[model samples]
Structures are given as structure tokens and as C-alpha cells.
Target: MSENTINAVTRRHWVLIACMLSMFMAAIEVTIVATAMPTIITELGGFSQFGWVFSIYLLTQAVTVPIYGRLADMWGRKRVFFIGAGLFLLGSILCGFASSMGWLILFRAFQGLGAGAIMPLTSTIIADVYPPKERAGVQGWLSSVWGVAAIVGPLTGAWLVQHFNWALVFWVNVPIGIISMLLLVRFFPESREKTDRRINFTGSCWLMLTVTALLTALLQAESLGYWTLVLSAVALLAGWGLLRHERYSGEPLFPLAIWRTRTLLAGNVGNLLIGAAMMGISAFLPTWIQGVSGGTPLQAGSALAMMSIGWPLASTLSGRLMQHTSYRFTAQLGSLLLIAGTAMLLILHRESPVWYAGLSAFVIGTGMGMTSTTFLIAVQNTAQFEIRGICTASVMFSRMLGSALGTALMGAVLNYNLMLRLPQYSDPVQQVMSPAGREQLKPANLDLMLTEIAHSLHWVFVVSLIIAFGSLLMSRLVPVQKPH
Candidate 1:
């Protein structure tokens, strides 16, 4: 292992570049799809099924994180990542040829499944390559990939759709993925000792079922009121079965005992609430801007873009912060910033300027970067090398779950208010998003609905503020970091 670690070809920077490119490909999937979906619908004409394309991808990705994380630990990060990247690239290629929205959604799900490995392993590999002091800074740069992807994704998609074919957008990741995989094969030579390969396949299946049902229920709460309840029941049963099995299984996939430690407990819980807060703001703040603040879509995007700015900037700085201060202090500071940022959001109104929204977004993003980075490093430091992959995956899994939870809960909040305030109208949120749709409504109706949207958005902010405070309190429970 030391021999490979010292090999000249696999310099830290090169591997970092590969990891960044790999993650950027995965991270950019949603935004690029957002840009290209119009063209896709025009050509393929599955406007009714459009949302499923994105949802299925994320659903598959989120469910597979724990699975891949466990595999990475058992086999090796390199091996698991190779399999995932191959699947993702294959999905990308197949998606290009998809003739219908159903086919595209299936292919995107494949891409998402691969992405589960790509995203979490980036950090796990970084932890393998870098020590504690350097880890935070390097991970900071890694965190910036999402920001870069967000900025770059739309432009790239638009250009592809304009000058080339919309189908080509799906193909773009192939070369990037190939290059990333090649770098790893060349640089990351892992001499992993074979371990017992009899994994708890049953537990894995049950876990997947549990997560899928729960996420589906949350995503469809407003739309599929009855089906959502059914899904929730299934999820609860699946979760119970998983727990029961894990207790008796010889090698549980979940590693439940580890969660008893304060370090992972506090860190994961904090990460979860932070995820909720971030999603609430990301999902709705733009709604406030476009529908309520009377801003253009471009202006609204720029407002949310402030988070992209704050995220990378704060992420890059968090390493140095950990170097000087304790992990607890750094994460605690981030938690405070989170509360402050969400509080700032409470002040936004129809009369509030776009920059004010941008400022709030920036503050929130800054807090997320700081808190997430510190906790990630701290968790990695605390975990045994053998379990490090799962530990890293746990951070991402918590965030992803938190995101799903937050989106559903806050969307419920927004929809409940809309239903009460605009009783005669159906799907006011949709009309709020579309200028043409807004024009179809009566002027008086439009004004009243817009006012209601702004009011409900404030309630969303209030929910986010509460979650942010929870994140802070959770951060307080993290144990002092011990160097591995």
C-alpha cells in the first residue's frame, strides 16, 4: 500500500482533479437536465412525465449511497467507483438514444445509481489520500465542485441544445467519466486484502425498500395524497424489517452500533437538519423571487447563485479554520451562521430587493459549507480506516435524506397555505412559476395569490429557521475530535 501511495504517477493533485471531474459530472446532472428538458419535451413530447426524469435519478442515487459505501469499504474505493462510473457512463449513452420519456427516466435512474458511488467516494478517497490537517482544505476544494457544476451546467446544456442536439447533452458525461476513470486506474492502485464477501444482501434490499418508499411518499405528499399514505406504511414496515434483520445478521450493512457514538450521532443529526434548512431555502427562495419579488428567472437564478459563491468560499476557508480551532468550534460557528442566515431570510418580503435575497442565500451557503466540511473531516478522523468509507457515506446519506425530508415538509407547508388562501384555484404554485399562466388569472386574483405566496414563503422561512437552530443544537453534541 505504501509503495503505491508513493508512486510518482498518482500525485495528490491529479487524483483530486479526477475526483472533481467525476463529481462534477454527477453534480451537474440535475441542472443540465433542467436546461435541456424543454428541448427534450419538444422532441420527445413527454411533458406530463417530465418530473419523473429528475426524480427517479435522484431517488436511485440516494438509495444506493449506503450500498456503495459499504461495497467501497469491503472491496475498495477504486473498485466500487469503477463499477459506478461505468454504469453512469453507460446510462448517459443510453439516455442519448432514448426515444420516450419513460426510457429516459429509466436510463437516468441508472445514471443516478452510479452517481451514488461517485459522490460519496470522492470524500472517502480524499480522506484516504490526505491527513486531518490537509483533509479539510482539500475537501473544501472538493465541495466547490458542486458550485462549479451549478454555474457550468446550465450554460453547457443550453449550448448543446442550441448548436448541437439535446441528445448530446446526455453524452457529454461519457468523455469526462472515461477520463476520470482512467486517472483513477492509473493513479489509484489499491492492494486491498480480500475480506469475507458474504454481505447481508437481504438487509441491503430491505434498506433500499425503506428509503425508496419514504422518499416517494415525501415527494408525492401533495400530489398523491392517498398513495403517499400507502407508501408511508410500506416504508415503515420495511424500516422495521430492516432493523429486525440487522440485529440478527452476522454482518449488518448498517453498522448500527457505530451510530451510538456521540461523534457520529451529533454530526449526522446536525448534518441532517442543515440539509433540511438548505433545501427549504434552495427550493423556495427562488419561488419568492420570481413569483413574489417580481424578478426575472435570470434574476432569481442569480439570487440563488449567491450560495454557490458563499459555499466554495467558505469551504476553502474551513480547512484553515480547523487547523487553528477545534472541529467542534468550527462546526459550532457554522451552525450559528446557519441560524443567522435563516433569520435573515425571515425579513425578505415582496418589497425586499433581490440583493437582500442573495445576501441571505450567501449566508446560508457559507454556514452549510463550514458546518458540513468540519463534520465530514471530524467523522472521518474518528472512524477506523476500515469503516471510513461507510462513515463518509453516512454524512452524504444524512444530507440527502435531510434534503428529501425538507423539500417535502416545506412543500407541504407552502401548499397548505396556497390551498387555504386560494380555495377556488388549483395548483397556484404552477401558475406562480409561469408568466403566461399568471396572465391567465384575473388581475385581482393574481394580486391576492401573489400576496399569499409571499406570506406562505415567510412561513417556509420560519420552518427553515427552526431547523437551523436544531442543527446548531446538534452540533453541540459532537465529541472532541481524536486524531486517527
Candidate 2:
């Protein structure tokens, strides 16, 4: 009730708001930009190069996350956050001015590097500021931002493109990022004397190289073909070198202690599998609705929207549930839901209703929401402040890697099945995406296309179900957290 206490409370709220805003900007950035890309590509006139704008951004973000995590812990969250947010906002400004696809790709890379810092630090800073009892509830608010962004971002992007210029999609981040940065600068202050500032340049380079090569191989596997093998080899070499260097370094960039913590490791494993399942559903569900079930794009999208609905609702409940129960129990419940959801997916076919697909998506998303929050809270609770940033970033990195792996794995299965049944078509999925496209084909070709796609996707669903079971195993392996 005292004035200083009231001032402190206000400052914390402002800081939380800033974190939320920063998170929203990052979360919405992909969806909004994607919605506007068709218009931007038409204007920029490099349809071939536009994919790099997204791939480069993802590669940079994933690679930098662990590096930024270590840096944040060593330098301080506020300092690192400012650097990241500044880079992101600057990238946004530059993207708005970009006249060509190449320039946009380069600017988006800058944005990705900044995003690498912002994502993990938001949770880390919230952990730093709030007490244990209050942290989960506040984290719930952060979780909801993702759902809100998912629901709002594309719609906003469509409106912006319809009425105004496509550049507004990039510019929109400017005001939001500026407000977030100013709020943090005012409310969240840091001191150089409080941080270690120990730079591990060699280890950092090795880490970055490893992540870059690995992700490059994963992302470019299809396009690069045999060349991906060389990248994969380089990634393995870099990874081995990194482990050796970190073993003897006085201050390791990636703390070795993390591997020794069973609960933390299990939590991250759960996150990884959850990420795989998430990618499977999000990537394929809409395609299933459109290609397999003969639904429109909007109908496909509406089915997918069920995920955003389930996610926010479950996230709001997860913190309270975790507060009242053990993390193991909550995570296990989520895993079971994942199993149920993925099982539901197995029953879907060309004749299945869209609402049924939507229901399945909702259940899967609810599972993801519950497990993700539980894993994050448990990881943070287990780690001390000196290592919290790295711990949090590890979670993010795990999920990213898992998602990439999932995309590759499911794509392989789908492609394998498609090729086995229908060998002549190089782009069967695309051929089946629209009714008009299918109508142009012979009846024999259309029947084969639909049948193979449905069969291939069934295997993809089977893989997701396996991943759900793996998550359950990880959940059971998670040692119950003693309350903080």
C-alpha cells in the first residue's frame, strides 16, 4: 500500500506489458507477413526468391537462440533485449523500404537474429520479476498472446493488403516494437557490474556453425538433394568440435550441467516431441481439409482455427492446474490428450467432416498448450538465475529442431507413399490442392491423386501418433517438481 510499493508494482506491470508486446510482434510477424507475401511478390517481382525471406529468417533465429541465451545470462536480459528489439525494429523499418526480394530477405535475417533473443528472454524476464506463485499466471498471459496473434495476425494482414499497401505489414511492427522497447527501457533497468560479461568467442562460433549447417541441411534438403549431405557432414563435425571445446572452457557457452539434470532434460524432451506433433498438425491439417476432403481454403483455415481456440483456453487453465498439482501429472494428462487427439486424426479420410477435423485439432492444441506451459515452468523453476536464459533458450531450440525434423520426417513419409503409388507426378500435392486443378486432370489421375494423398497422410498421422506416445514417455520420466 506504500507509495514506493505501488511504484514498484506499476513498473513490473509495465515491464510485463512490454514483454507481451514484444512477444506478440514476434509471434504475429510470420503469419502476418505470410498473408501479404503474394502482394509483395507481385510488386517485388522475384517469386523464386521469396521463400528465402522466410527460410533465412528461421535459420538465423534458430541458430542465434542458444548464443543469445548464453549472452543474456552473461550480459543481463535488459541489455540483450534492447539489442534484439532494436535490431528487430530496424529490420522492420528496412523491410518497409525494401525495393527487391533480396533486400527483404537480408532485413528479415536481422529481424530473426533479434527474435532469437526476444523469445526466450520474455519468459526469463518474467521469471526474474515475478515470485513463483505469480509467475505461472503471468506466463499464462504471455501464452494467450500467441493464440491471440495466431487468430488476429492473418486477418489484420488481409485487411492491410486489401485497403493499403503490402508494406504496411512490415511497418505495423514499428509502432508496436517502439512502444515495447520504450516501456522496457523505462521500467526494466540493468547494471554492467551485475553481469559476468565473459565472452566465449570460439565456442560461440562453433555453436552457430553447427546450428547453421544443420538447419541449412534440413531446410534445403529437397532443393539441395545430394549437396545436403555435405552440409550435414559439416554440422556433425561442428557439433563434435563444439562439445570438445565446451568441455574444457572455463565458462562454457552452453552449460554442461544442463544434461545432468534429469527433470529438466525430460521436460525439454517432452517439448521436442510436442513440437513435432504440433508441426505435423499445423502443416498438414489444412492440406487435408482442402486436398483430401474437397474443402475451400477458407473452410480449411476455419478448421485450423480450432487450434488457436483450444490453445489459449488450455493455457489459461494450465498455470492454475500446475499450481495445484505436480508437473508430472499435468504433463501426463496433456500427453494422454495428445494420444487421443492424434488417434482421432487416424479416423479422418476423404469422407470425414471438417468439424471432426477441427475437433481433432482442438484436442491436439489443448494437449500442446498444457504440456508446453508445464515444461517451461518446470525448466525455469529447476534453473537458477545465472543459467535461466540458457535453460529457457534450450527449450525454444529443442522445439525448433523438433519442428524442422517433423517437417522433414512427415514430408518424407508423404512423398514416399505418393511415389510408391503414383510415380509419374513430381508435384501431386499441388495438383490436388484445388478442385479446378483436379478437374483439369483425367479421372484416372484424379482418383489416383486423391487416393495416394489420403493414404500418404494416413502414414503422417501414424507418425504423429508415435510422437504423441513419445511425449507421454517423456512426461512419465519427468521427476515431480518440489514446489519452489
Q: Please, what's the RMSD in Å of model 1?
A: 2.1
Clash-forming residue pairs, model 1: none
Model 2 Cα shift for residue 399 (angstroms): 0.8
- In order, candidate lDDTs are 0.85, 0.85
Stretches off by above 4 angstroms in model 2 are: 1-10, 191-197
Tens-digit lDDT track of model 2 for 104-211:
999999889888988998888887777666666788889899888988999999999999988899889989988998998787766223554687999989999998
Worst 10 residues of 1 by lDDT: 1-10
TM-score for candidate 2, residues paired by index: 0.95
Each prediction's total of clashing residue pairs, residues at least 3 apart in sequence or on different chains, is 0, 0
- The reply for model 1, stretches above 4 Å from the true place, is 1-10, 440-444, 480-484
